[model samples]
Target: MMPRLDSNTDPFRRPNTNHINSIYKQNLSKFQNFSEELTKRYDELTPTKKILVWILAVFNVIAVVLILIFHSYIIKSLVKLSDKWADLKFGHLLLFTLVFMVGFPPLLGFSPLSLLCGMVYGFPYGWPLLASAMFTGSFASFLVFRYLLHKQAVRLIQANEKFRAFSDILKEDQSLLILILIRLCPLPYSLSNGALAAIPELSAWTYALASLITSPKLLIHVYVGWKLKSLGDETKTFATKVVDFVSILITGAASALTTWLIYSRMQRKLEIYHSSRQQTNGDYDAMIFGNFDDNDLSSNNNVELDSNDFDADNFVIGDEDDDEEEVELDEVRAETDQADVTKSTSPTNSP
Candidate 1:
């Protein structure tokens, strides 16, 4: 039963604030749902697996300490293998190391290898060697996938719902933009390689163009290594060492921030695409992004303006029109939408 308003109630108070509260609740509910989705897998872990995770985490901490102490020595030993191809009379070539980072299983990976380039070879020499290898390796992989493995890759993508959804988004005009964003993200090299490879229509030129945009990212690793090398000089004063340490920290923070922003923007795009798909009834939106609730495709997505009886003089300064309700944007062209204008103007008409 609806409660009747008191006749002597303060008119300045919002007479019907339920709509705003409901909107706030819907958003809060979505956030909770998202949080639950993220933690579901962790919550489901068995006792044995949880113990294993802790053991591995402890070992990882120990490994990090050991690596930090002997990192420079280890990096140098790895870089200077003394293989004839790697060791010329002039200087050691890091091409093979970078190539291995790009190829199957992807050992050591791009991050450590590029850092090794900067630390061992140092900049001016390190930047170009690593940059050229990244470009050429990515180009070669794109060709290999697009021609040699196209059929198998297509079959694999078709067999997976998630990959199929990813492929669909790639076909859009924003495909190149998406690729550039993915490159900027701090994901595994092989992961990005497989994703780009799956899209049969994605050209080598387009892939190269996206890769070029991320050229600055490789420089970040080299820059960090360069800074680290500066800190190792025994002759440097305390103040100089402090400055170098701070700069390395700042550079690392900046790189992390850039990757986070890029990843967040990509996520927002996916959410928007998910919302639009829900509106248009795209059944497959759930595969890539998680499946949403009725809140997603709410029938209440159109504007609804209603008044039991609005009083202008009763409105006080700093207080909104105590009774109005506004909903989501439902684009209505006046010329074409004139027919539906009388459909519903009451807030109660929607969910």
Candidate 2:
């Protein structure tokens, strides 16, 4: 026979099911309304954003045109200033040095100006003067860059994945070798200096060490410039071109070789570090798992008995009492074991 159900007797209830359905419908309607409102707001913003973009584009075009119009006048004014400052021989060298430090990376050229410094100062005086100027300017620029432009430089470096990886490699050793290599080789002097300054791994002392080691290259350039000053006009022109070309080619080759060597060395070091780390991890696991076979726990049990504190005679029990106690304990243990075995072997009876 089918069971007759009573509302009072039934544990499961469905009261307010219609109310819950109504609430759910209301919530869904509210959500749809809110979503539509958001869509309307976004649609309103689209046209405003388009207008702003067009305004920015128009302003950029005007700025570029203005810069083009003033470009020739700016160049002429700079030339006039250069002529006025030319009479101050050392001053000219210093000015060029400042310009080289500030503009070299952006302009990507400085040799012509440095040669002009040599032409002004003449051989013996020029080489020393140019070298001094370059070193001072470079040193000051490095300090300023380390303090002020470091964040920007870091951003630039992080933009390139290869450079970012190279930075991580620099963190391992923090040695001056990489900095000196970049400086001694022809790897864009100002750019390399600024980039190196941004690296936290390169300490001030390390930077100074690299600068001292790499100063010789600047001296070489100064020497070439000084020698060029003595040659005839035509010879000087030809020599300048030859020297510039040779310097670029030689520096490029050296930079490529150095970069390769640095990368290879860094790779080898990283491999060694990873191997050591893995070995350390393995050792840690062995210790944690109680697999350290060399540990001898059993040997500790052989510690010599302290006769002064404990006497065998004092602890001794007569044979009769010992035998009686042993028999009684054995009986108790036997009874407990029998009870456990009986419980395990017995089948369950329903209550």
Candidate 3:
């Protein structure tokens, strides 16, 4: 047997203990490991990129300090900027609408960008600004996979039994609910966009509409940002400030409770969904997703399919007349899986 490595060991091995201090320690350990992983990746960047990264870091620190020192001035400037934006509001909002569609922005991730929007436009503007963007962006991905890159995407999906089985749950009733739950989950946006897009059973408009269920999360984040923006207002009386503080407290508590409830509900629904899926498909095929944990849904990780798992059961290799197409698709799946396997598995992955 191969020797077990400490680096491969999981921190979650301990028995459940709901103490607050234990929770803090667990999170601290995770954060430390996450930072170390980020540092290692940063080291692998090119020298030119490293210089640009340092410059960006320094600028961010300076910007934060300036914002802290001149918050009142900054608020006044922002208010004036908001007034100026009114004349060309759609043009400004339209530009930001493209942000989520663009994916993991180099410097600014979606969270901060969404918060910035909330800070600028407030809560009422939240869904109105992002609703069309989210739907359109997701639909565009679907279109690419279904039409533009259909051959490439379909070959990948058909390459693995797991991928096909994952798609097969569409046969079950309330499949749309599962689709909605998926969009509601905090999975990587673009990957989910492409994954759902690649599935033939899911219609373009159906998939796009399911995305709207996630709008509440956008609202919660933007509402918090709106509150943050309000805190900077110099005109508020002490009583009003107190009121705002209390409102923030209420919002935070409600959001936390609501998120927890939704998460729990989604998990239970997924368990049932998987159960029904397993029963419908053969036991061998269905168990592929059986091992998947719902809590892992919170992470930004994506699984790449391995073509070695491909077989006649899931795929339709083209006829004699379409010999060129069969060979091309087989080549495509093999090449794609080779790249995926290389990226996912290193020397340490070997047993």
Candidate 4:
């Protein structure tokens, strides 16, 4: 082995540097593109969601800062408040439900309430307690929108083409699928509830059932708030802190990934559904952007073209009268030539 140390023939020869670099570049490019797409989609969030994000961010920062500055006083006050509210558990729940019901609209989202529940009751108790409030709040909102705000919701839906298109999808028998997809979408929960209210066909029970089905997603936000409470605990061991940190990280990552996936899937479904709607109506642009009435559609359909006015059959390639004149002139010239030939032959004989 020592005598036959041929570098070229060695099995442990280094791989091609160019090939490895090419593979690395390809993977890097793919990852960059994937990240760019996610960024683009995130930037396209609805105005409601953007507002919610801003509010949550500013509130969290201000709260954290104030809590740090007045830590002892704040804790003492909260402990006193907790003691007073401890025996009034049902009252606390009822108050939360009332607040949620009042605020669970496009103007005010339910996310903050969900987090409050988690921070107050902890996850094991908080999840179910919040779920109940959410259910009640959802049902209340549905009733309010369906009855009290019916006209306004209708006006809202009619004014927005996207909402109308989504409403059309909900009008179908497969509306459950559409509603679920919309719920799973990273859109504002209030918007979904309001839009569902605008649809007369979507029964109150149907909306309630759908909310129950999709309520599990609230747990993700609750978990975040619950873990955040752990951060303030001074008695936690190093191992506990590490576990909580990891748990928070994993939970956040999973929630984000799940939201992105749902958004992507919902986007594809919307595109397909919108395209089908456009095809059905045969108006791609107007169907998407224009609020067309049945009268307008019917008027457009009733437009008629008269074939006689076009007269396509009477179109001649060339001038027929000019051709006839040319043929007559040619015949007259031939006859004149014959007459001239006869006259010339007769004159020559006489001479």
- Best TM-score among the predictions, by candidate number: 1
Report the poorest 10 consecutive residues by lDDT, candidate 1. Answer: 323-332
Q: Against the unseen true structure, what C-alpha lDDT does each candidate score? A: 0.67, 0.62, 0.67, 0.72
List, residue by residue over 1-351, the lDDT tens digit for candidate 3: 998879537776775467778878966986898799889979999999999999999999999999889977876776555445545748555546655555421223566556556766778686567555656666777788787777666665565443454465554543667677656654556655655557767888777667766666677767776776676677888788678768888987987777556655665665677887668686665455434557656677874555556655676433585898888999999999999999878666456
Residue 131 of model 4: what lDDT? 77
Clash number for candidate 2 = 0
For candidate 1, write residues 249-297 as lDDT tens digits. Answer: 9989988988878876766777777787787676555543446567755
Local accuracy of candidate 4 as per-residue lDDT tens digits, 3-32: 865778878889889999997997698689
Off by over 4 Å in 1: 1-38, 43-52, 67-92, 100-108, 150-166, 282-351
RMSD (Cα, Å) of model 2: 26.9
Q: TM-score, each model? A: 0.60, 0.42, 0.49, 0.57
Alpha-carbon shift of residue 349 in model 4 (angstroms):
74
- Model 4 C-alpha RMSD vs. true structure (Å) is 14.8
lDDT of 2: 0.62
Residue 90 of candidate 1: its Cα lDDT? Answer: 48
C-alpha lDDT (0 to 100) for residue 151 of candidate 2: 83
Q: Deviation in angstroms for 36 in model 4?
A: 14
In model 2, the runs with Cα more than 4 Å from the true position are 1-100, 103-107, 122-125, 226-351
